[model samples]
Target: MKNNSAMTKIPKGYTTITPWIISRNTARLIDFMKKTFDGEEIARLYNEDGSVGHAEIRIGDAVVMMFDAKKEWPDTPAFLRLYVEDGDAAFRRALQEGATTMTEMTDMFFG
Candidate 1:
C-alpha cells in the first residue's frame, strides 16, 4: 500500500526493457551508431566533465541508452539482436561503419 506516482517520466518511443551501453567515449559511440544504424539522438544528459552521463538514441523502432564508463560502474559488453528490414543491407552498413564481420549474413530456420 505505497503510493509512488511521482517518478521520472519515460520518454516517448521507449519500452519497458531498454539496452544501455557503457562506453569509454560516448560521443564517438553515438556517432558510430548514427552512421551504422541510422540512429537518431533522442535525449542526452551530460556530466560536469563534458562526458555523456546518459544518452538515448533511436534506431528504427529500437531505442537504446548509453553513457560513459565510470569507476564505480565499469564497462560491460553486451550482445544485441536487432531485427532489421534488410539483413544484408544492415550488415553491409555495419561493416561500412567499421564493424568487424563475425559471420556473413545468412538465413536461419527457427522452427
Candidate 2:
C-alpha cells in the first residue's frame, strides 16, 4: 500500500477503521468500556424506547462506536486490541466487569 494520507480525505484525529459493537445489552457494554478502559464518552444517541441507538467512546486516541442490536438486526460483535499503560490492570478491570478472556494476556514486541 502506498502512503497516500496526504491525498486521502479523512476526519482529523480519526483512523481508517473504527470498532463497532452491536449488542443486545448495549448499556452494559458501554458501561463496561467506560469502567474497564477509562473510556471517555464522546456522544450517544438514544432510541425513543430508551435504548441506545448509537454511541461513541474514546479510549486513548481510538474512537469506538457501538449500538444496540435491534430486532431487525442480528447481533454483531467486535473484537478490539487496545494498548494501555497497564495491560495487566486493564485485564483485571475487564474481568471485574464480567469479561472473559479466550486466553491469558501475553506481552507483545510491538507493545
Task: Give the top-scoring candidate (TM-score).
Answer: 2
* Number of clashing residue pairs, candidate 2: 0
Cα lDDT computed for each candidate against the true fold: 0.82, 0.86
Off by over 4 Å in 1: 1-11, 71-74
lDDT of 1 by residue, 1-111 (tens): 775453346556776678999888888888888977788998889999898999999988889899998867766886788877777887887888778888777778941
TM-score of 1: 0.78
Put down candidate 2 lDDT per residue, 8-83, tens digits, no spaces: 7767766888788888887798799999999988889999988899999899999988888778987676778888
Return the TM-score for each candidate structure. Answer: 0.78, 0.82
Itemize residue pairs with steric clashes in candidate 1.
none
Model 2 error, position 31 (Å): 1.2
Model 2: residues with Cα > 4 Å off, grouped in runs: 1-9
